[model samples]
Target: MTSNSPKVLVFAGSAREGSLNKQLAQLAAKRIEALGGQATFIDLKDYPCPLFDQDIEAQGMPDNVLKLRAILAEHQAVFIASPEYNGFITPLLKNTLDWLSRPYEDTPGLGLFAGKWAALVAASPGGLGGIRAMPLAQQLLANLSLTVLPQPLSLPGAGSAFDEAGALKDDATGQKLDALCQRLVDSLAKTHG
Candidate 1:
């Protein structure tokens, strides 16, 4: 009922090309691989769905939603890098979680997120580092019975933290991301087996 490879999924919750949150996710992936975990990032751009509707539900769930759930089923843990939209979690991120939680109660691989560990990270040009989104993400994961790590890194001033090639430039922020990602790797290692 488990996998041979240790799966560490990374969710980049922002949709902008200049998304600093995505950079944090990229950094997390590097650290995951460094710690012997397989890192996979689920980009929200690839997971766009309309506002959930009962009418839409009557038509059956969408293929893209199922595919995203399948990706969750493949992983043992998650590292979410979310952007704050209108002082809350991005609708894209929330909607993805919504689709992932289909059947509301019992379901097949949709249960993949249950009991799985998750870590939070955020990046933004604003002073708060897109942190406005963290509480909601954590709560939703908890509602799904996912074990979310408490150490969240809200990466403010993210624009200066990376270079032209997207490499992390700030040693302090890099170290922070390193520590957060290590937690994910350790959590996955402990939980996957």
Candidate 2:
């Protein structure tokens, strides 16, 4: 069963003060809200989790990890803006997912991701638009049982893609971003109903 408004959580992988991925995430959240879904924007900087280490897990999950897990559980869908670091997802995003995927005493395995709906977007100053990272992110999420949208946004030359207001400057690119996000919003509404 679904509520009248499906809560969609949005977040970026980067913690940099002026990250391109953060801009993309904010734009996605606006699109989701415009489509009438409730959008919850989260900053990973505020919910830092330690690097996923087996020794650390044995010691017990950190408070921030637990907090992020609870926040994720509250959302019906998730939108991620990941940055590609050396042709891979940033350590920040990977670590957050790893910690969140761990099973709590009463939670089912893969509870954070299993059957979850996800949409992906990436931005980078480089010309490739962080496209190199999408497949890996998709694979990881798919492995965890997330039904990720097959097509993801890859904003090339992100350095100049946005205007002073943080919105995409290129009309074509902005439309593509909007369309991708709309697809996720519409799919989630359809699935929940």
The model with the greatest TM-score is 2
lDDT of 2 by residue, 1-193 (tens): 1357777889999989988899889988988888778788989999877788889889987999889989999887889999999999999998888888888878876888766799999998888999999999999888878899988999889988888888888998888888887888788788875
Least accurate 10 contiguous residues by lDDT in model 2:
1-10
| lDDT scores of the candidates, listed in order | 0.78, 0.87
lDDT: worst 10-residue window of model 1: 104-113
Query: How many residue pairs of model 1 clash at the backbone?
Result: 0
TM-score of each: 0.90, 0.95
TM-score of 2: 0.95
**Best-performing candidate as measured by lDDT:** 2
List the pairs of residues colliding in candidate 1: none
Residue-level lDDT tens digits of model 1 in 6-30 = 7888878777775778877887887
Model 2 residue runs over 4 Å out of place are 1-3
State each candidate's clash count. Answer: 0, 0
Model 1, C-alpha of 23: deviation from truth (Å) = 2.2
